[model samples]
Target: MNKKKTSLLPKNFLFRLTFINIFIVSIFIALSSWAVYNTACFLVDSMGTMTGTNQTKFNKTLYYYLWIFSLIAMITGSIAHFYLTKRLIHPLKRLIESTKSMKKGNYPEPIEVTSSDEIGQLTSNFNGLAHQLKKNHEQRQKLVMDLSHEVRTPLANLNGYLYALKNGVIEGDPALYESLYQESERLTKMITQLETLKEWDYISEQSFFEKEMAPIGKLLHETVKMFEWQLKEKQIAVEIDAEDADLLVDKEGVLQAISNLTENAIRFYSGEGIISIKGERLANEYYIAITGPSYPITEKEGEKLFERFYRVDPSRSRDTGGSGLGLSITKEIIEQHKGDIGWKTDEAKNTFWFTLPLETACTSR
Candidate 1:
């Protein structure tokens, strides 16, 4: 048996380009031939007696040359079309392959940018997307690990206590009961905050905010009131210097954002220091900030504070109990409202501030 011979023409896109170029060349040759024939006829008619043997020979030669030129034009057009189309489509082919790799949970190496064109820009954007996906994947895996450890520790303690009680290995007393209750409560709080964090994450992704015309001062006051007991216990005075302004915002979401900032301030406040809560409108934006005692943190550390499960204090003590999801949730909430949230620290104090559009539309960025 003989092997079938492969066609030399490029396949797929290149083949289509080849066909198109040949068709265009054929049309151009046909139109040129028609024009030339009409011009020759005009010249023969003008030369009245010149239409003889020479005219016949000239017509034959003209047709022969036209055929040869048409063949050359078609061949040249096909070759050029194939070469250029192949080069243009090579980047797209790589992009498709990279996307396939990403679909399989593999982050392929960045494709080299070969030109300063739209194609290069597209390649650059794809690389950026891949980097972000890879980063998110690593963060997700880390979050799961952290979540398991957080849940397991408290459950293990509860299991141990229950087992001891059942086997009569330890006596059930007030202190023991209180300890078990605290463990359970901690576990519940962690789980609850985790749920809240996840909820806000979804809300942020969907850009879901129930906007209402709410008084900024009232919202700030309400958030402060929620921490009244804690404030009194710590002797931390909350001074609210807010100007009354009606903002188009999600009432509950803004309250939660303010509450998270206040909570963190109280948790890390210097002894008997004032927690300054300020709200004001500057130009087209509503600014809200909670300033408290400065912790030992750098600018980079402050940036990471908005990330889920990222704790500012390394101790992770029960006294300052947090699942490290509050700030993350707050960030999501503020962002969903097309607002910006950030923290700034001086030597004496750190101010966590967020800004929202003063004249916010129902569905605006």
Candidate 2:
């Protein structure tokens, strides 16, 4: 059972506002009438009682006109006050309704901004917030669907293996167990990477990092060292041609970004090849590029290289032990450090590059 929540404000809030404004106007009018009356009486008394009858007639006429003017002002002023109050309160009412819609998980249409006042600004800000929330909601839905798609195959594989073992349709062998374990491990790794991508996506907004001034060249060297065994196994030679420029960045994040790029290079290298890693300072930015052998990718494919779960060759990536989120995580880390990441193809070689601002406060492109 659910109960509807009650609002704190009264239903006749606009009426109350109108009444309060009219009450204030009436107070001012009454004070003015009292002052005028006192002044008229003083003037009449100052006439030294010479024209007593005339003064009496003048006092009556003055009082009568004063009462009539006050009556007229009160009526007209109340009507105008009510109209203006209604105009101001109408937008607030619309905002409240829009808020309720959002609370019910339905995004509302943009509220019209009809003024250059604070209320108009508030409405504009609310529209921007609604747009962002709607975008996030859509992305979340897509993520759930993509996650289910990625999980289903591995789960099916594991279920088939378990069913066969339980039904005694096939004897359990070491190879069978290894295959099942591999499927389970792939599922675990995909989920872990998805969680990592989610965490970094959130952390990017907060700018959370342990930033330090580190040499770009040294970071590249360290990243290459981390993958020495894999590079040697693949017979891939990594050559670093980097400038020893200092960058203000999070060392752990930068290292992770570089490591992802390096691992990607090793994974996609066509046969035994040389992977060139270059870092240079261009203007106020430190640029890093990793060039290695890869299959031809179109401009459209290149554009989506950093999107989560995106793969140019999904089977090839899976066989190479990729979760299809390495580049996405790298992009997140680079952007969080106020940088840009992209890729380009030249002949048979593909180059993945990124740029970091020399100053940590610079905006990302």
Candidate 3:
């Protein structure tokens, strides 16, 4: 025989609680009735005029009435208990079904909030989690598709060039070889960036980062100096206004983030334009901003600017030899430090800014 799984008691939380409360109440009533009957018997025994028959009759009448009253109370309590349990368990059951749907990759209708209680709060949290999971899953799908498209172009070009050379359709001229080498180099760079992004994703997901109190101003200055050659090549003037501020962060990660921002500024700034770097303390955080002259970007484009392989201008990204992962990596680094990074633009300038929490106790490295 196929036996269905069964629970000895109600599995719903409210039902179980009600059952326990009723059981305790019943025990109290029974004890009280016993005490009342014993007191009645003692009083009757003290009266000499009362006979055995009278005593027996009195006891029977008292016990019968007590049983009837207890039965009435139990029935009333059970009716009230059932009503209360229904109100509370209905929402919980809906929530359980929603979760099961989510497990099957189906996002069903949201649970309705019927009350302001712990259960209601739990429902709200569950809704938020479901929304987040759906968003992340969509983003993951888009990332995979984008990555595939990005890799295919370079790969196709490399394959075509190599095939042409193999068939003797193209001579072993130095220029032809150089072109082939550049295509291969582009692929290598893309692969390297992909690997770096993967590592960064792992680190961010694991909340893993080395923390040390490091000077923010010095880091910004050093990062700017590292790009001096590019700044000069682009004929871009540099301005720096940094204050002494220390932050607890992964030093290498911070350095890399600053370097990436500076490199981005150098790449996009108009020739002979100025790039400004600023670092200062803002309340409890050290803020760093990099501003450069560039074309304006729409709000929609700016929203996905930090997404891997996303580019404000695809042609500009190619011309500048960008892999389109720098900002994404920098965003992760800043977020790992429990901070924020974003971009803002005006008619004359484009600014990328980030912040890190300031370390109160400064320590020398």
Candidate 4:
């Protein structure tokens, strides 16, 4: 199936707006002309009857003057509309062209427009989106390259092992056999994780999960318990502060989201790093606050943290067995559960958190 392109030609937002304005002006002009003509005739009829002059002759001159005045008014209004439309059309065209270039996978070039109006707001938005898209595209391409490299290493080792065995270069020693088995298993696990990520992303994209009344604390506990071994192994201390915490969300979807987030925390935390999982029910919403031990999450990195396959430290990330989709998939799942997600970072504090709705949890609160 062929896809239709949204960005191709320069759209005229200003021209469209001017067209409607012109239509309204024309209607007002017509109504005003009718009223003026009627008033002129009324005055001529009243005064002409009193004077000793030809009433029909005076009425003819009055009608002629009204027609001339109407023509002049229409012409002036049209010229004004044209000028306004011109002022609006040029910038709009520039914006449309920018969008088209971006749609074609061109990183948007820097655009500067000084006009302070709705059009300027649009320009700012366009520039921001373009910048993000360009950054994301570059990062995604790099991630794919790195991931392929990672996967290839294990597979190549396994293939060489098999070739050696077949050619009788290496005997069927248990140690060599175990090494081959381990490499193949590592490759298998990587494939499984990638597949699971793809499926989670698909489900999230389709909006398959629907909102429901869910016990957030219980799910958090369950997810945390599942990672108990990893948490204990790392000497990471976890503190849970749950008082009145419930949310309106997709049950399984929310569980999967927090699980992914916690997994990420476990992978990144240092020895003796403290992890806190807290939940609070606000008047209109419920929030799950997951704060892990600090690493370098700068302000800019926070913005792109949820982006697909974005890694802060590629070397450290690979060492920690991060596939880079854990946080990204968690973000998508939270959105699907009819919730919101965000992170905070600073010199002293770096917390990854998300919020769910409390509208349906009114009773629980």
- What C-alpha lDDT values do all the predictions have? 0.81, 0.83, 0.79, 0.72
**Model 1, span 78-167: residue lDDT tens:** 788778888887888788778878877799999999988999999999998899788778868987998887778778889999999999
Tell me the lDDT of candidate 3. Answer: 0.79
Candidate 4 residue-wise lDDT, 1-365, digit = tens: 12333332333444566677777877887788778878877887776454546766666777788778777877787788778677766776677677767777787676787778888888888888788777767757876886786777677777888899899898888898887777776666566666766666567646355567766778888889999998778778888886555566767767878887787777777534578898887777777888886676777767778865566553534446555666777777777667789887655445778887665675455
Per-residue lDDT of model 2, residues 153-269, tens digit only: 778878988998999998999999998888888888888878878888788757366687777788899999999898778777888998787777888888989988988888788
TM-scores of the models, in the order given: 0.75, 0.88, 0.76, 0.53
Candidate ordering by lDDT (highest first): 2, 1, 3, 4
CA lDDT, candidate 1, residue 345: 82
Which scores better on lDDT, 3 or 4? 3
Instruction: Give the higher-TM-score candidate: 2 or 4.
Output: 2
Candidate 2 ranges beyond 4 A from true positions: 1-11, 114-118, 207-210, 314-317, 361-365
Pairs of residues clashing in candidate 2: none
Best by lDDT: 2
Could you give candidate 3's per-residue lDDT for residues 72-96 as a string of tens digits? 8888987898787877677776786
What stretches of model 4 exceed 4 Å from their correct place?
A: 1-150, 161-186, 205-211, 314-317, 346-349, 363-365
RMSD of 4: 8.3
Residue pairs clashing, model 4: none
